[model samples]
Target chain A: MKQEEKVDFRLNREYCKACGICTALCPKKAISADDEGKPSMINEEACIMCRLCELRCPDFAIRIGRMQ
Target chain B: MEQHVFDRLMRDDKLPHMWCRGCGNGIVLQSIIRAIDRTGIDQDKAVIVSGVGCSSRANNYTDFCGLHTTHGRPIAFATGVKMANPELQVIVVTGDGDSTSIGGNHFIQAARRNIDLTVVVFNNSNYGMTGGQYSPTTPVGAFTRTSVYGNIEPAFDVCRLAEGSGATYVARSTTYHVQSLIKYIASGITHKGFSVIDAMCDCPTLFGRINGLGDGAKMIAAWPEKTVSIEKAGTLSADELEEKVIIGEFVNSSRRSEYTEKYARIIEEAQRERADLK
Candidate 1:
């Protein structure tokens, strides 16, 4: 994969409420939730950069950006 | 970084808003902020006014000028502020109950006057702040705490009501349609006269739990199935459109004169008459 095609995805732990919205909304299923319901990027390479998770995140916990 | 754009506009000290998990108020607030950015409006000149409700807590999170007014009175206070200084761009962020129940009269009156204010009503269908009581916008046959046997009252079509009351601009959008929601809100912000953007939100904790609508994601996923764009609705028959919520702009006209500018003209004429009489 090209370096420029990579997307920066990170969940802010301090801001997250473990609502599981990011994992649920990702069309590509690139994000996954743990047993505690906290979300993390499980497939960074599969991300299409659609930004659905970031835009629809109720808590604004998920931040997605393009890597330079 | 792009993160600073949002950070500079927000009071990070108030991080992690007090709303329940998966509440749509946060999404609505974010859309409003993004719309303000889209309009290129001066942050210092804009004011966010809100009435009492779960959605009314939005002003506390922003760094711009804000007024967390009493229940059902945000529009009245915003009117007073606009009348005093017409230069300020006023935006009202209110809930369904806050705008339709106690503030119903003010809401209609503001539209009638064609004031230069953008009113955003976060319609969660029920009164989330007061324990899922059936609000004026709550759909009939829906279960609410006040309507244990299901709500018999018909819901208010917010856009139609605003258009009927003479709002120059009116639109309706759901939280799931983030891009459209942002565009509608941005257009509302730029509109000169009274604009009402009815934001259909989800109170997942109270309303959804009581109605068996599943969780946050499930409720949002159902939006596309429940609503149809106005253009598409025109092609569908009445029977086919039954029980479907129509989304998109209903009215956008700038024919009427704005309240503040007209008032200023009246004042100037009165002062000129006094000078001639002297």
Candidate 2:
């Protein structure tokens, strides 16, 4: 949960259909949906790189990787 | 330099795809690409063949050797391609209507032949491109344009059909389980003989609208609750599992010889006989 911890993520907002699967399944509560239903990482520090969001995004809009 | 995955894999010119918002085709497409990347397949040697339908459009967006073939004939087309060049990795992307309805014969025949081809059927339950008509895999009692009174016919379990038809590898996954889909797809591609990945996708526009289901995203979000893992599915009775989608790898067999391999053996024997006569 360090502030400097590197948790790289990329979301193709254009492809996102705002299904909220990632937000619902994220164990760390790292992803959340906006009013429009589009998802964004709300807590990068909480993301233990579990990749639930990246794996469960039905639109293939999210990609999570560790910053090298 | 490590290139961005999508940049290296997708056709940039075809930026925005034609699928409707919330359709699971994009998810399945990405899963296939990720599988290919994970397996380290040579892109130059990979060929993607697709039949007519929303799923077939995947060939148009992928940066690989692609063939958009006639409706319900991708399996047949892919069979020939694999036979001609056994070295190339051939993958067929097809819809439920294209694969199991109009192309049903080819599907079973390909599996029976044990051809070395990876067939990915995007089962959105209805024909999305031509309006929401019930397809071969559409569940009974589901509403569709053609099934106004409800789809009375029992749906085919695509994985079970493939397994019965002699496919070497058979697996099922939904758009909700992207990781499992990718893993199964990669395993299917690596399997020697015919491999079938039945990927359940959500057609929010056609299937969802006609069935009174919500939009694309909602339909996809509902999958986890609607489907059960194959292992867990066994614990449920037939009545209990009636409406639930079963997801898992149903078969993986290395015993059967691939069509191309069998053909090669025949050719070798013929050559030896000719040499003996000479």
Candidate 3:
């Protein structure tokens, strides 16, 4: 059986002010907002790891890791 | 464990900063650190100087030789530091109020001198630290604590001011455009002469709340609507571009001699003349 591909996303929720910039700039539509407007991974399988969300995050809340 | 770029540059002991949630200062700070990392500059040779204001607090988070000077005096202090040690990379971080309100003269004079210093002006359009008072860069008709009836004073386009004052490099960008902002900042740092980056940041807590601009997320989302690229702005008429923030490099004069180089040359010539007389 093939192993499932996985990527890690570290979010510092304390720092995140729910700016949604990452969600808006993500080309793969992999990030979405939760009920509190904070960002969350909606489709990790589709993530391209472009790091756009990580770079554009105003609060330094998001970090993208390599796929495994 | 792989450390984040900021983690290596920032003073981890000061983790969890005091800036309000959703403030764009963090974005600007990240861009600066990223620029420094990309330039491969020696951290030991870098000096971060900031003036009194919310933006000035950035020096507290960075691990470099940081100096939090008097209000609106970062440029003057940075200039002295650059002159004393031309080998050091002096970067000035200041707020709209600190840069344009009280430090306006120093800002223009530094540009006029063409000193080798990189200045990043965090322009949130109001005095964020002081309760959202309208600043010199505040757009006309913007509501603020002091401008309850709407601001009547015209705003100063920081890029134009720097260019007019003879800065060798000048650029503008907002927090929303992270890539361009980082690129411009890196270019500014690499530039040999006076470089100015007028970064339009969002002061969500004070400016947004008072202006009805919603939360930090909404304010950033609306940045695209308020800003126009320099290339696109060129094609638009004055009326069409009203109230739009222009983002792009306005000047880059690598041919101009930097202040320290010129001064050093004068000193060298004087010493040679004295030696000949001896």
Candidate 2's clash total is 0
Ranked by TM-score from best down, the candidates are 1, 3, 2
Ordered list by lDDT, greatest first: 1, 3, 2
Name model 1 segments beyond 4 Å from true: none
The DockQ values of the predictions, listed in order, are 0.70, 0.42, 0.56
Model 2 alpha-carbon miss at residue B129, Å: 0.3
Per residue, candidate 3 scores C-alpha lDDT tens digits across B166-256 of: 9999999988888899999999999999999999889988889988998777798788898999999999999999878889888988878
TM-score of candidate 3 relative to the true fold: 0.94
Report the lDDT of model 1 for residue B146.
Answer: 94
Residues B117-220, model 2: lDDT tens digits: 99999999999998889988899999999999999999988988899999999999988788899999999999999999999989888888888789765787
Backbone clashes in each candidate structure, one number apiece?
0, 0, 0
Docking class of 2: acceptable
lDDT tens digits by residue: candidate 3, A1-68: 12444767888888787767788767898989899988889888789878888887766678888655
lDDT of 1 at B234: 99
Interface RMSD of each: 1.1, 2.8, 2.0
The window of 10 residues in a row where model 3 chain B has the poorest summed lDDT is B12-21
lDDT score at residue B8, model 3, on the 0-100 scale: 82
